[model samples]
Target chain A: MDRRDFLKCSLAGCSLFLVGKGLSTPLSSSALAAPPSQLSRVEARYYQKLPDREIKCELCPRFCQLGDKERGFCGVRENQDGKYYTLVYGKVASLNVDPIEKKPFFHFLPGSEAFSLATAGCNLSCKFCQNWEISQMRPEQVRNIHLPPEAVVETAEKYNCPVIAYTYSEPVIFYEFMYDTCLLARRRGIKNVVVSAGYINPEPLADLMKVVEAIKIDLKAFTQDFYTNYVRGELQPVLKTIKQIAKSKTWLEIVYLVIPTLNDNPEDIRKMSRWLKAEIGPDYPIHFSRFHPMYLIKNLPPTPVSTLEKLREIALEEGLHYVYVGNVPGHPGEHTYCPNCGKVIIERYGYTIKKKELSGNKCRYCGQVIPGVWS
Target chain B: MKTSKVVVITARNVFSGQGLPDPRVVLKMFRKGLELLTGASKAEEALAIWFKPEDRVGIKINTIGRRLLSTLPETSITLGLWLGQTICREDNIIIWDRSNEELKDTGYKLSNTPGSLKIFGTDTRGAGYTEEPIVNRNIGSLFSRIQAELIDASISLAILKDHGLAGVTAGLKNYFGAIHNPNKYHDSHCNPYIAELFETDLIRRKHRLTILDALKVQYHRGPSYHPQWAENCKKLIFSTDPVAADAVGWKLIDELRARKGLPSLKEENREPVYLFTAEKLGLGQARLENIEIVEEEV
Candidate 1:
């Protein structure tokens, strides 16, 4: 069903909620009546146990070596008696039925609805995190519902959403849950997609690529200084992740949030475009998202539309195939223009797909094949 | 220049045969530590120097280690009761940590009686974190309302242990429990984040004292409880300078490590450099030569 039908069904008490401005869901009556004090205690995937009851987490580049009872930088994984456990597995903190375009996969399954959810916690702490209420919190700090992998897939099927998205907060922190749900969703003929900051290890990302169909990475910046001072992460690892995803069969899309005076350097954007063209080719789509003052970055103003347009122009000039501007409704850059005929193949306004001039992954006017999944 | 004074009060039999602290001996140590730290003949005069009678004083305890290696209830309750009896109202004295579960696991009964001593955590019904983030230098977090709004003065009654990242988890590091995102600050070996978090006005302005519970020092492979590397030091460190108290706590951990033929924290390349950062921020003295340590057996 489309988002309009989904909204009408939600209004008719369909037990599904739409994600709105707050980015949070009210606790169900059952969850509120008996709040769970304990979080999920599943064993984490990538970690090495050391001597003296200590364990080093290998999930992210941080490699947080923790003592017994100490949590990693993600705040969702902990070391208990020399064993690393992910405390957020199956703990659904936020649930929403959103449009596929909200995940901003402009090239994948346009105008369809996606069943999206996220657990509490993230590996990277961005200074301007938009979803800090859930992303920057531990599992215990947020209200959660116990939705196992089976339940997630079943809900997606019930809601008629062909794709399930691990989004909102960083999905890599909830790797186990997302991986398991992807596996389950695959068995039921459903597609899986992930939205993340891409601050993940290669091994986990490789395994994730095998199960998911598409991945959208938030490339915070091109410089290590921006990663250190603002993102609390490393740029090399994120670049590595992007390269790895591009090499794999998974469809890749990139989003660069343009902050005022932070990462809006045109030269850096030129460099990033050149690098992406050289390493990953130009078939992938890149979105220059507008950033607003949020979390700890209230000092700066919202990114100007002119800045995004300039950055988009630079990326297009660098021989990139598809580039777009995001978070700005009704901008001409929101539409997908064909590289061959230069006609707008797909028109969009925010999360809504206004029109599609495509016939079976090809431009209807010129028969130029577009690089995306069109069924 | 006058050096910061740090008082170490020791008791040989502070712990009972069952591995719990003795309340009576812990109370004696508090009395002695307060008297020596303040240069007052009595502990009541020492309490008055830091707190007013109407002040709501918060004793921020470290309970992440649970019962194995937390700031024991016997030690913190004695200090809280003493502070209540000497200066603040009984109900105004709060003994708290990050969560009610950890506090309960560490043998702290949840209490909020109107005319009695209050013991709880930041997770209490009316005591969550502040809605907005407080930005201070590189640190930005929502502080616990108990530390930010409820209490007029704070005493970091923390467990003295060797942290895997921070080199030493002591008085100043205890304030990590007061923020909502301690995990975010664990990067860069917790260097400037720990010091910067303490430099925030919610901590620096209201902080009145530092009390390190060094009765059982986890000298190696800690902030966790590893009995093989644990040592019974039977000491409580006190200082008005938050950095000096943690610096002394670090020394005591090094002393314990030396006794066990282990490398110093500096050799391990994780030397709690936040102490030096704290020193630079004018929070307190981190160098050993800049501190006057007064030791006495109670």
Candidate 2:
């Protein structure tokens, strides 16, 4: 290797060396991650092979009709020699143990830690993607650990985490791995949770619901224009996913990241609040997340704290019970209020729950049922 | 405004039954196309105008489809060796794509010998993508170091094929392989992103030529191999304008589709509208009326 080439490799941080075809020689980490050319050949689910070697991915609304050597928009799945495969399968890019509330599942397991994991690639190309390091990259672009589904469950068990959260990046892109991990986690008396953009199709989402205990959907905006322009996706599919999750036994939560003037228009928030109250009911906790300038949307300023508060007020005024504000750590709006008793049911300081005024899903102050999984 | 010129050079029965493209015939097509496009007296003169003797040339070929359908190795190496022999040093020219396995699968013998035409991929041990994604308008991608740093000049040697989403794949789309994440840009019929990606300084500044290998065009059900739809047209398309080259490729695909009694890309609603988008961005000409199509039988 030349001097410049070695410098480039070293700049990529820690990387494993490829020994041959399938084997990677464990050397000291220095250099770029090996090209994910060593992709899994396992055929993907929810896809149909066409007349030629083309395959149509029914995983999301994109319905990517991929040719051989072509990948879906998600950047993880590939149509290799006619059969479709998820390249990021069992390839974990990021892993950590964090509070379940960090996924911001305010209603489900408030104080418990979630064993978080993510693979690279997301179906939607959100301009303001906070986790773009992993989400926007191809599997080879990022440093990855080959943690199989069984290993993931074992690691979570070893860490004493009750929930295995598929988060940081879009879990939908790594469906097979997440599904298998969820199944394995369930067998071991552990729950699985998904944090996604909800840019998924009905069949896959339905299938995913059977495995996951709860799902947190990031509803970026209320309008279709925002979806088309900024998200590179359709808003209707996310709406459908939210409605589907609400219908299923899976606990559902929504997060609308208010990005200053982009998606924080009061009328749009009001419209979204009303739609949420009518479609998924007023009980599903909707968090108005504060958007910090990130990814491609760095030119925009962070969402004003007042904007998030106002949106929270509009949702509450629209008769939505579980509206909350996110990101601004010490904001009083982070706490879940009892709609009936006008009392703070679950007082939280960021991801840390300070106190829980609840008795088995019912608010301790008013005996009102809070719609989430509580033990 | 200066009109774009695209050349279509055909060498009838250029491919042998053993699946090798005739080097002499392919070289003749390349020389003729360049001579016509640049209005130069000789092929070497045509190349010298765009490249310096010391320039490192990267002949980027689309080889995702393996052996059955990809830019024939003989044709690409012939052009690379021609460039090395004429304008640049043989050691400086690289015939590359995305990965070594893909290059091998496409029937390329991996070579990195100095004083010889180097054939490798971005995934070659000493080569990979740039550290950061070069963001350009709608495109944010990590470019291959071969395109971003190693090469001083580029020639897109792409295989002509009908894409399911982009409607047509040619010279401009060939650069997709030069980036780390091409899968993300395939949305919206590859509109805006394809144009925007080509606009990136890494590609736009370095790219000098577009050569589409239409030896066996996959007219339908393609970008992949479907023998029933593969046509042995035995042609090579050339242009300085990337969009105009792909636009000509789109027309050729539609013509083949019509002959096979299949719907046009427009009728199929997967028309590579990216050409129009590219034109609007002032990259090149999208209209056939504006592009002077020079046909030759070499």
Candidate 3:
């Protein structure tokens, strides 16, 4: 049924106890507020139209040349009878009012709550995909709530959330949703943050940087071999994205999921840390998150706490400023430490921010100016 | 040593001038192929070796490419009817694939008649994939209810075509439809996954036959229809051994490719290595010499 009929049918609610367990509800006239036809109709900026109704999506490094009725590696976007269409435009699969620390964006807006939203589908088929229930599915396979761009901003404002986070499933798959949401959020004086896998192309990445406030890229692994064998993607594009985001006004942070044996190699971590320090400079926070066996890659054990700590030490030794360990609830590494004075600037436990030892942008302990969106 | 024979039967007039396949000729070819492959005097006797009269048989057809390049409805329906008439009850037969939409695209009329032949797909609301995963070797996927539940025995009635990734998609690769996630198995040129999926109990226990519809072989740039490469070879291959059947199908694709002055699949670096993997897993014979192919015109 269409949205209008569905709304009308919902309003004729009776006190049917058979529906039981407080199942039946009467919809107010305002509850049927036309369901908001909020579409993120931003013309995709990085696709080249080819002859015979084909188009090569330059949005990501996959460079998917799709024929009619075909989708890119990311199942959300489709070539509908020759025209390219993002099926997940404004299709919100999951939404939660999460603290900024939950996005593990420890450096960016440490204590503030962010309204996070995600649509189904992802570009890379990582065997150890955490959000496979949504990310690995087609847009139609998931239950989508109609939280369009305007509605998203309004919800954030309603919840007193300062930031709107495009997260959970890879935001790159729902590019149009996140992009337009960022634009709307920006107009409403709300910040926009994106959690991505950094698998996007330069052109789209450049366009995204214009509206979004911060972007946290999940660098799945350090080597190309791991990217290919495990993640079904390339590491070069991620590196390129890091370089591009570093130049942009958008605040950039990188999250490296330290999977045991697969990518927890100290040598690779050291090299990655050095690259981050050399290229993006030390201020950009690199998260060495713990990995649990998930999806297809369930054979290996989770990364040991020592391994994450060791990686964190390596990053710090490599002159990285804002390195953090994630997924370990009460670990000391979860807190953000000041680069100069080596004091806990922001204490965190899992998604919760316990304390902020910073006065404005500077650490209260040693008056060291920590580089992030501190207010 | 693996003891199995693959029979290939071809008929030039399998398709009438109206572009629809003559079901009678196709049925005759199927019978001939089965009889020769099993060294049975009659096709029904050969079928009796594997299938019981009470078995609910599912003829799994490839319909992803739609009518232009798919296992034609006429061919599948004919096989289903023949199996019903000669081997089992009409009500006990089901010609199926992944989705109803795809079945319709390939010109199949969906049926669930109580006392007549039925045609449906896994995406039939009540007949979705099995909720739990069946893990075997490199494969971990939820098999379609049509494959895992509804049918007692399975027949992979596939269309012979060149694949962009797997070199060739034939009888064994056709079982990709039996599982919910064919997309995941496409990695590594469908190496161990293809072989392993066939090893799953839902498939390996129930699968009885492999019949490749080589009536119109797409020699190159295929699995999708590119008219220039399509050839109406007018053939149907049948075998109890799934790997041997696909091995013969691969040889046919290679033969066509070679005739067109195209490089061998090995030279093109896209050979269907899954056959060898399947052979190693004891699914069937992958080596060309092990399969006794009997080619005949019906």
Candidate 4:
């Protein structure tokens, strides 16, 4: 089911049915009925114990130094009696089956279904977070289902989904859960992808790169000022994460949500495109997503369609190979054009693939090779 | 310019050998602190200044530290019951925190009986956070229904502690528990966010008093329980000006840290700059020169 249907079903206490390969099976309600108070006590991976029952979480850039019975800035990890633990280890706050295109990974398995899930909590507090209902809440604040790593992989297989996406919320905060699930999904022959704001520390990012196949990083802004005011994060670390992911074996895509008067400057987009070209080259696709009035940023109007079109043009001009406009259906910018042939290789309207001119991984018009995972 | 008045009340033998506070002595200290704070002859008269007979008063307590460093049950219950017996009805007084688990862990019995002092957390059924975020400058969060709708007035009965991030988590910072996403506000030593959160209409309009539960103060390495740095100062700080109350709490922590041969919060570069931000927002006086100190032994 879609995200809205899943939420409605979960809230109404209805039995969820898993549909796959023309067969449907009832998912046990008990699995999704874990008491809100029940949280995992798994010891966290990246943390150092300090004196007097204090611990410093090293997973994110925040490096939250917490005392006994205190939580990190993510609100999912807690330090209990000097031991750091991930409280949301198996707590799935949201689960959905969505088109891989919804993750906006234009070049990765286009039109394929993705088994997506997310735990509550996020490292960054973006002012316009679209999924604030789950991302900005603690594990206890949201309704959750206890889907362990094995169950997550099994459910992906049952749903005939080739890819498992750690999405909706920032996957970086749920690193332990995502990492473990990635390993399990890999062993089960299912691909694992992550959608995050990329506010992670280098050590954890390095380790995470080994397991996940693709990562979609939401590069919030180009300048540190926007990162500080609107995102409550540092721009340097996100840039570092993007550079790291590009160098790794994993596929990387960047999404820039163009909010009105906030990080929508064409100059900044040019600089960002230049930086990406200089550091990571032009192979990776970058989606300039339209920003809606969400969360704390409701005062501003929806990002003007012209703004998205203009930013996309700026990136394309900056030598980026793949630049697509998002959230605006039937826009010509939604199509993926072959950099060499300059022909539309993949055409789309919203999340659906209306027409594709790609022969395997090549452009059908000119037989030019396109960069993406096309299996 | 009138200086904000702050009262510090200390009682001898407030705690027994078991490290538990004496309820009777704690109640007496509250009486003296409230009376001295309002310059009233009686505690009831002092409470009447801020609360009415029909007002539903919410006592927001800091219980994240559980039993070790939380606002102790003896201290908060005595004050809560006293408020109930005075200006407000017993049933209308709610002594609450962020979660029922915290309240239970901190030695509080869950009580929501009518015509009696109600004790629960924001997570209690029918008492969750607001549906929409209450947005202020640099602050947007879902405030607890208790703070936003259930109560007409609020009193921050917060535990005085040395916070590693905020420098000092006192009366003003305690209201962080009232919001759902307090974790999101810890950036930059919780500076402008703390001040900005208090400036919100839900908090600034309803907040009536600030009471720092300083019977045992965490001088360093705190917001968590650290026995080595904890001090038994046997004090309760009271003020109508929330910023002035927290500023005084900050000074008391520095004094305790100094006696223990530790660096001051300012030296550590984590002194609560939020107090100054609050003062700039016209919340209260953050400077000692702008505050009138009234100390008493009960």
Candidate 5:
């Protein structure tokens, strides 16, 4: 439809609400709160101060060199008066208590709840972003709740959550706040898990690894072209992050959303699985989630369930042990089967643990030691 | 189909003694530029070509740079007044940016009087972004309701500055204020996204004209102001073809950089290549060969 006709319809929709107040004076809303402002005085590591007040943001592969008062590509970190500050530090836009299974960490404590939080702004602009309302906005543009580090730990304790999950939007954008919160949560014996696209530089990732317990990287696609066109980022750095996690003590899991025409080729899936087996070993779980048509990518339809099942078959055929399907509530692919005994060990139905046949960390049916952090 | 004509009008005394835009000269520049571009004998005739008496005209200004560098109040007010006198009523014209705070910082009175010209921001209480995303090409953004719903027509009255990424911040880049996520499109020097955004029905179909306020141009190291690199070019550019207008603005910046013995935008690896992308999409002519240059002194 034409914009004019659409606008006319919109105005007509609001006409009934306009009757309460005269159009002369606009209603007053509350003034914006600047308490958790962008004045994060925390000293940033992994950056070099250039000549003439410009600083290169080495926290990501983009390495955006910004001038005074300019923000980096993330829209969260800014160079204010020649220093970098993460704008979304302790500025939570969305917070909820979700099952650890929802983060899809089949290896971690299955039924436990993780206190999840996300802030405004992301490092990359994915065309099919499900959370674009918050992720692709400046901190000032969104309504943020001030949940500082201590409050975060307190909230987790209050909810009886054993873990704090940094999920929803990109956690790398709120690096400082997540780092500090991880430290606080760790001291309180609360485990920390990160659900990220894993688009970060090495030095900062190393620092983050020292605090968080488990990391779930959403490897968006296997190709650099897909990363360039859809995600507005580079694929190499994300691959680097996965390799880094494999080398570290942190439990690592990978999620790849299979968007039908975009990134769901069986050959590419086979290549990625083979690469993962060679580099990180086949123990790490890889979830090929279903992609919904969202944000700018509404022209295309969602990935077919059969396509996801086929891709799962390809990954398994390529010597990967733990391969699963996501976003489909009750498909048989959601269950974890023992590679040794071929029996269903963990049956999942939409983030809920329907059945568990594991005795401690070993398979109850076959007595094979499963490669997972099943406490 | 016939292509649109773009006019470039310059004035000698665009800057007043206090070292900002002189309102009187800016009005004259807008008048003559619009008149010549639209091929109208009078200023009112040019304005009547696009707008009607009952229209609510939105003057979308750029104020992200705050007070130090922004679309000066004088240029925007002069256009608002001219628009108020010609096609729309005074109250139907609104001068706006992203926020009331930025507007206040850039020296503007926040007004919403019934019969007077209204001035406010997109963040003004009831005026936030649209809940749904407008999906077009690779540009998916929640438009500010002020631009998408509040007004009937839009005038991109923007500052012409050398962008640190886009190479030029003129009329086309000004529409970034209308969308919620401009920071995301800054990659690859804002190539296809800038063009694709302008092609969106939210912007392209409603955009009536482009007026670039270039009285004091920040030619280099910009989008932010450094007084040392600023120059008083004292000019305003008008066009219906948005790409052509920005193309001229890019040339002007290159000229300034050359005069100062600095590198060209291409040499610096930040050229405004988005114009070519826009041209390839059939938005407008970006090359100098196709654009008919018109220079007038007001």
Candidate 6:
């Protein structure tokens, strides 16, 4: 977002924030550096204490075993004197009331406002990270507002937001803070949702699925080579997360950002669509998001609308129930259609839900049951 | 083949008991190092061989371990002051690390004197990291302005220690402190990324020296302080070839580990092959056979 847009978005009551000064220029990162006073020393979860003041983090597949003063790949958790601590426990880098559609949860709550928040630092270093200003930084390198779990719950309640979103940066990195906030938000009659890279370990993912109502996993690519060479992560763990979430009662959605000449191959999309159909079944919504020139991958052009359309067609042909093309507003792919009886069940323009013709869980036109939480 | 030279200097009585290295003896070691490395009669004349009067020299020290195990203030300041008084202007040399807090924790009083030997960190207001990242191979990191824009030449004045992750943390690994994202590079025994980071023009072009402070070496369970595994090695290794300097330092760590009946870093499967990667990049020689070791005790 630009400076003007940031100022405009700050109209949400009782909220304060500071974005990087220059919109065109990259964040000096100096602007993001939080003072020492803003730091949190909260002991972390999902880590094993090893001998001699060392630790091995099991939060993710990396399983980073660190000596004292060492940090995991995520850059938010650290091993301080043999105990693992989450430096960004309550440090919120970005907080705003965003449309649930922005998270592209077309199936889950089409038009509801979400209290979206994120902390600095992400586990995966995607070469084309869209939110690198905050995601690709240590807690000390970002300006953070100290909003404890109670404060987060209260903020969502005050804003009249039905759902709270752990998003922007990878939510799994701030699992402790997010999990605590989720528990509090749930008690207060609010729903909790997560937007993540799905890079979490099975134990943590299993635990997280029990607390959150829904999850949006950004499946970077179908290939391990893409995960390794570009995303600096493993593909199997992400696939496992999808499978686990599919087995759970919690709502699940998948987004595949198609970067030009990167992960946009037709063959990979066919394989991914077939796999999703076989494992998660045809009910789960899959989005083919358009990739822009961002972070370190600025040289490539934005994903062509033709590419998104073609991929959407491929997925649809592969028998996936609901496939949407993202990042291009007003495209037919942005709207929801009933797979049982083809009709526009929910028309959307950008983040705005233009029209909804659904009665409970079924399409109003054909009495066909379209999956998702509509209440 | 022109083999690299590594000078290992020691003073037996430099630390008879628990105290910092004796400044007088340390100065003699530095003098001998420079004279022998450059074939000069004095240290000041030796500095002229590699650095010009106009160059701003940055002595990048590893200060992550706090007071117990870090590049001590005694070694860095003494060397910075000597370089200022001899080769460059007093203000031209900056002894720096990642942050002011780490520097302070390592017993360094933050200084930003415009016309004196300065000792501070990247967090010292104007010395923060650059806005954009310098991309080279697998390394995409924002370099501290101290190493990128402020200094014309660089020195990795690193602590010699056995790293749990990198197998050894020395000259090449110390450059990790110069970047904003060292944590990202620590994967895979810090291979290729360490070498690639050192190959970045911001580092490779400016780096002029490598000095490993081995007064007290942590032979095992380190990159952290565990007195049981640490040894008072009473040594300082000097070399212009960074890979060779760290390779020699790695050999010392393994030797100490062997003496203490501990398995090698390789047996533990965390060997630092980045030196070999660095050697492949023509940064320096990694093989001991290709490096000449010169020992001295002052």
Number of the top-ranking candidate, with DockQ as the measure: 6
Tell me the tens digit of each residue's lDDT in model 6 across A1-375.
764454334333224542221112223486436755357999999999999988999999999999999899999998999999999987888877878999979888889988888888999999999888888988888667667787778777777999999998999999999999999899999999999999999999999988999999999999999999999999999999999999999899999999999999999999999999998899999999999998788899999999999999999999998999999999999989987778898999988999999999889999998888888
Worst 10 residues of 6 chain A by lDDT: A18-27
Q: Model 5, residue B91: displacement in angstroms?
A: 1.2
User: What's candidate 5's DockQ score?
Assistant: 0.30
- When only the first chain is scored, the TM-scores of the models are 0.92, 0.91, 0.88, 0.91, 0.89, 0.93
Off by over 4 Å in 5: A1-45, A299-302, B1-6
Per residue, candidate 3 scores C-alpha lDDT tens digits across B1-298 of 4477888898988999897789888888988987888788998998899899999999989997788889998898888888898879999999998767778888988898799999987756577666545678566666777887788998999999988678899988889887655655665778988898888888889999899999999888666677788888999988889999898889999999899999989999989998899999999999987877788888
Model 5, span A1-375: residue lDDT tens: 665565455334233222321211111112222322333546566677887677899988889988877778777787777777777777776677778888879889998888887877789888888777667777777656556787788777876989999988889888889999999999999999999999999999999999998999999999999998899888989999999999999999999998879898788898999999999998899999988988778778888999999999999999898999999999999999999989999999988899999999999998988877776
Candidate 5 matches the true fold with a TM-score of 0.91
What candidate 5 keeps of the native contacts, as a fraction, is 0.35
Q: lDDT tens string, model 1, B1-298?
A: 5589999999999989898899999999988899999889998899899999999999999999999899988888888888888788989999999888889998999999999999998877777778788999999998899999999999999999999889999999999999988999987789899999999999999999999999988999888898898988899999999999999999999988888899999999999999999999999999999999999998
- Candidate 6, superposed: residue stretches over 4 Å from native: A1-14, A18-28, B16-18
**B30 Cα displacement, candidate 4 (Å):** 1.6
Query: Tens-digit lDDT track for model 2 on A218-288?
Result: 99999999998898899898999999999999999999899987998999999998898899888899999
Error of 5 at B179 (Å): 0.8
> Alpha carbon lDDT of residue B159, candidate 5?
91
lDDT, candidate 4, equals 0.88
lDDT of prediction 2:
0.86
The CA-based lDDT of model 1 is what?
Answer: 0.89
Interface RMSD of each: 5.1, 3.6, 10.0, 5.9, 4.5, 1.7
Candidate 6, pairs of clashing residues:
A32-A142, A32-A143
State the displacement of the C-alpha of residue A316, model 1, in Å, after optimal TM-score superposition. Answer: 0.9
Best-fitting candidate, scored by lDDT? 1
Residue B71 displacement in candidate 6 (angstroms):
0.4
Residue lDDT tens for model 4, A1-375: 765565454434312423332112212221122333599999999999998888989999889988888888898998889999999997887777888999979889899988888888999899899888888888888767667787777667876999999998889888889999999999988998899999999999999989988999999999999998888889999999999999889999999999999889889999999999999999899999898998899889988999999999999999999999999999999999988879888989988999888889999999988888888
Chain B only, TM-score of each candidate: 0.98, 0.98, 0.97, 0.98, 0.97, 0.97
Error of 2 at A346 (Å): 2.9
TM-score of 2: 0.91
Instruction: Indicate whether candidate 4 or candidate 5 has the larger TM-score.
Output: 4
